[model samples]
Target: MPVYEFRCQACQRKSSFFVRSIGGSLSPACTACGSREMSRVISGFAYHKSMATIHEESGGPDRPGSDYYKDPRNIGRWTEKKFKDLGMEMPSQIQEMIQSAREGEMPESVKDLQPNLTDV
Candidate 1:
């Protein structure tokens, strides 16, 4: 099986179509808006990472260090891992909050953690 990606001209959203063989034909429609006008785009490739590679880039979640939290991807990883360990899906709201924090939004509750600037 092969997957081909196309960008819908109408909505500018991407959609993928799967072909059973390399010679198969496809007339994929926009998944979002059902538009027939589509443009083929280069899709990102994926590869499998070995255990060693994963652990090396994992930033030592179990092992602690001052710099461990420097990477934004590392933030909320503990909560994510916890949810995964419990075999439960994280609520969309919490996921959104974590994503927002990763994108540098300060949560309202953490605003008080900031030092009083006038006192400096």
Candidate 2:
């Protein structure tokens, strides 16, 4: 089996499709918008790392968009983008987090959590 990446023009979301055969009769639809019009996209590979390196190639903390995530608004956008990229439904917990950030408030549970001694 092989996985293929596709971008939907309508929703501007990307998703992966696992296929048993390439030549067989099969069509892919956008998981988010249910649009059949999609284009193949080149997928990037990811790897696990023990530590992040400050380099352009590795996309570390020093990367251009890294600072964008620090903003609460951008954090919500990033979360939506991530969910769209993975073709996964945004979970309720994540939705609440984004909503709270957009509203300039932290979730009550996160705000009320007391730091453990071990964390310090």
Candidate 3:
């Protein structure tokens, strides 16, 4: 499916329409104003990253930097990876907590888990 955005002539608001096929017809009306006069908008584009590229960007599990934990992308990454590495399914409760953390609300119990170290 492809998404086509349009600018409404009457309300000047933007509306997007999802087409099932590239060659299919899409008559997009302004969802806000219900106007049929829409001008096709040239949407900005983006590309996806492969697993290798993503792993490389995060500095991988074995070599995470001091600031790696600060990255929002790594929010619940370690817990998920640890479960996968152990060949275990993450519990639904833990999965919910991780998802919530990723969505921006940190679980009170899991906050401020900075590592503690001593000269050994």
Candidate 4:
């Protein structure tokens, strides 16, 4: 089985079709506009990751002493890994604070976390 994507020349709309056999010819008709003049399109595909793999690579969010800011040396690498794992933006304030902490100047925002730091 193979999935093929097509784009309508008239309406510029894109549609996808899943064919059972590779030998079969695809009817590149635009579903939206019913246009016969369509072109096969390059489309992106989905990728999946298991939870175990994600946790292994991301250091699972619940793990203790695994805070990115715990060690000064982990400043840049940890922050990047955390943000990449969570698939979100690191707030500018937090980013600035991390940079400051990396430079030996702890920011006031994270001062309360000082006592929680442990030797990893």
The global C-alpha lDDT for each of the candidates, from Candidate 1 onward, is: 0.68, 0.62, 0.69, 0.66
Give lDDT tens digits, candidate 2, residues 1-120: 556788998998998887688788658899999999999886752112222332443342223344544455544554466578889998988778767766787665533332232432
Task: Let me know the TM-score candidate 2 reaches against the reference structure.
Answer: 0.36
Off by over 4 Å in 2: 46-120
lDDT of 3 at 65: 61
The prediction achieving the highest TM-score against the true structure is 3
What TM-score would every model get versus the actual structure?
A: 0.41, 0.36, 0.44, 0.37
**Candidate 3 residue lDDT tens string, 3-101:** 678999999998878768887778888999999999988776211324455667667445676667676666656667878999999888877776677
Per-residue lDDT over 1-120 for candidate 1, one digit per residue giving the tens place of the 0 to 100 score: 456789999999998787677776788899999999999887753112245555665546455345555566666666677688899998887777778777988586433333333543
Model 3 alpha-carbon miss at residue 37, Å = 56
Residue-wise lDDT of candidate 4 within 11-102, one digit each (tens)?
Answer: 99988888678778778789998998889886663112244455465453335345544567555555556677889898887777877878
Ranking by lDDT: 3, 1, 4, 2
Clashing pairs in 2: none
| Candidate 3 lDDT score at position 80 | 73
Give the best candidate by lDDT. 3
Ranking by TM-score: 3, 1, 4, 2
* Candidate 1: stretches off by over 4 Å: 1-58, 108-120
